[model samples]
Target: MLPKGFQYAGVYAGLKDNGKKDMGVIVSERKAVCAGVTTTNLACAACVKRARKILRRGAAKAIIVNTKYANACTGKQGERDDAEYAKIAEKLFGGPVLTASTGVIGQNMPLDNIRRGAELLKKELRDDYDAFAEAILTTDLVVKKISKTVQILGRDVTVAGVAKGSGMIHPDMATMLAFITTDADIDRGLLQRIIREVTAISFNQITVDGDTSTNDMCLCLANGLSGVRIDRQALPIFQAALTEVLIYLAKAIAADGEGATKLMEVNVTGARSLKEARLAAKAVAGSPLVKCAVYGGDDNWGRVIAAVGRSGARFDPEKVRMNWDGLQSKTVTINIDLANGRESAQAWGCDLTEGYIKINTKYN
Candidate 1:
């Protein structure tokens, strides 16, 4: 379920030839504080640019998203299309709106279809969270969503999120899109800070094919409808709850990677700093050799060691302790001790299989 004061709707946009639900909207009854983090890729989608601009205002009332046409690499026309979508959303929803798109880069968006879909979405706006989740997917096989209620200030605050991604995923922000909604009252600056911190440990620690996409993004909206102001005393609790939601969605994305048969977890400990630990963990998670070894169920700890060695993290191989027994349970935990400090980090990824190659080779 979505947080209070927000309505969601998903409709078939004709952007996808299969007539799948390709457009969705989330509208808040009142203005909400919003913060977003987008892909660092140079070839970003127009929707990403538009969302950044809207977030600069520090608040928003609606979010419009479409899948199956990423609107990336379409040059100036793509920017126009994104602007038009925002305009349409604002006109219909009566407030500022942000936009997001995913799927099929280097192609022009079907503007006419998007316009029609916007109309249908307006009419279908309701509390259909499942439909909204289904509409935001491109190649994803499952709907990734989580909802949790936490007590703050003697009131129940709800936090819910949805995400979509399957392939072209890596650590510099996974090839994924996530939107989180909450009913806790929080300051914009603090909310943004929490989002960045949570993202660093959650979304930034996952990988699939080691290829980042041009449309990756994660956004959060706090509508404060629960009448609970998150003071400093409660910030830690709220942040933990929010992090839990993001980590769940992140793991779901990795486990559901295209043609993935199992999930892999890499742990890096005793690093000199958090940065070193993250670098080492992500390197191991994104290493194709390590991924293949996991897929074959081979006790190839050498590949894991090689990945960490090349990760640019200062580590002492003599102090590294690897445990491959976790492979029997479809989990691989590699502990690398740099013998430098006490910082540690973990990353999640999926094994590479023949099916992954087949899926990507024929994907269009």
Candidate 2:
């Protein structure tokens, strides 16, 4: 419902034969405090590597992006696309620029279209969230946008976010490129803490597939357009709002997961520690074997249990437990109860199926 600020044009970048909107720009009207989280994949995309460096100063007024080709493995020239984008943003917006890209892997980036997209953006920048949403999606079945208005320093501030990932979405920093923008005045240190806290439980907690992307980037921009300062005192509120956006975007990504039909929430509990719990959960979430079982609706708890066992986390098999959509699957769940301790952790996830394979095949 964000009235779309930032005009957008989807001039067939030829990256996708479907002629979908691919290249786009989201520019804030003012300098905004920006916080971003990138993929931990050692072979990160050229765009992700550079976006992290650009957002370090906690400010970026414009974001340039493309979706047909992942700006990865392009060698030194790929590295150059990052700086080229910043330069593009500067030319169009007269401000600092941040860039992000996600699509086919190991393909050369489309720099000429990117440059043209920037020029098109300059001629048509507005407050239309729809245009922005359309521009960022690749293989997404629908447009994605999440926003919330909350009190910051006793003043109203808005946090709006959008993401695209119908595939390659195991976000240890999640495989999707998500950008969040807000109109709150926050310094870099506080912005970093809030973003870190928000992403930990939100983005880092979900997985459609075990595959993490090289181009995953989640960024938050706070331009103070709402006239509120998200000072340290108001950190908690800001964190909550940011977390809301992250969770929304993550779920949307999952719901739109390539060939995904039913979205799921797996909660892993009764672990000795949080880290152990997360490892166990991720193991279940990322397991294709477990996912296939879920896809078949076979009520398979052993796969879940097996995944947990292999997670390298400690837990008494007798003390571990499992549930499907909150109902205890007696024949399928694994539980190990601690004889004396009162600590445990839970994780979230979904099922996989042939439809997933079919979709990728069709899309390609």
The whole-model C-alpha lDDT of candidate 2 against the native structure comes to 0.69
Model 1 TM: 0.95
Quick one: best TM-score, which candidate?
1
For model 2, what is the error of residue 21's alpha carbon versus the real structure, in angstroms, after optimal superposition? 0.9
1-364: candidate 2 lDDT, tens digit per residue: 3412333334445555676666777787776677878888888888887777777766777777777677777788888777777787788785778878777666676777778777776766666667778877766788888788886556677788888875532112224878787777778778877787777766787787767778887887777666676656777887888778888887777666776655555566656677776676667767788767766666577877788789877777775555554223311232433222455543445557677776555454
Tell me the deviation in Å of residue 76 in model 2: 1.2
- lDDT leader: 1
lDDT tens digits by residue: candidate 1, 1-364: 4589998899998887777798999999899999878898889999988888877777999888988778888899999988898888899986788898887777788888889999999999887588889898776788898998888767788889999976432112225999999988999889988999999998989988777788999999999998888888999889988999999998889888888888888888889889999999999989999999888888687998889899888878888777765776756665666677899998999899987877777454
Poorest lDDT segment (10 consecutive residues) of candidate 2: 326-335
Write down the RMSD of all candidates, one decimal each: 2.6, 4.1
Model 2: runs farther than 4 Å from truth?
A: 1-14, 152-154, 168-175, 326-346, 361-364
Estimated TM-score per prediction? 0.95, 0.87
- lDDT (CA) for every model shown? 0.85, 0.69
Residue clash pairs of candidate 1: none
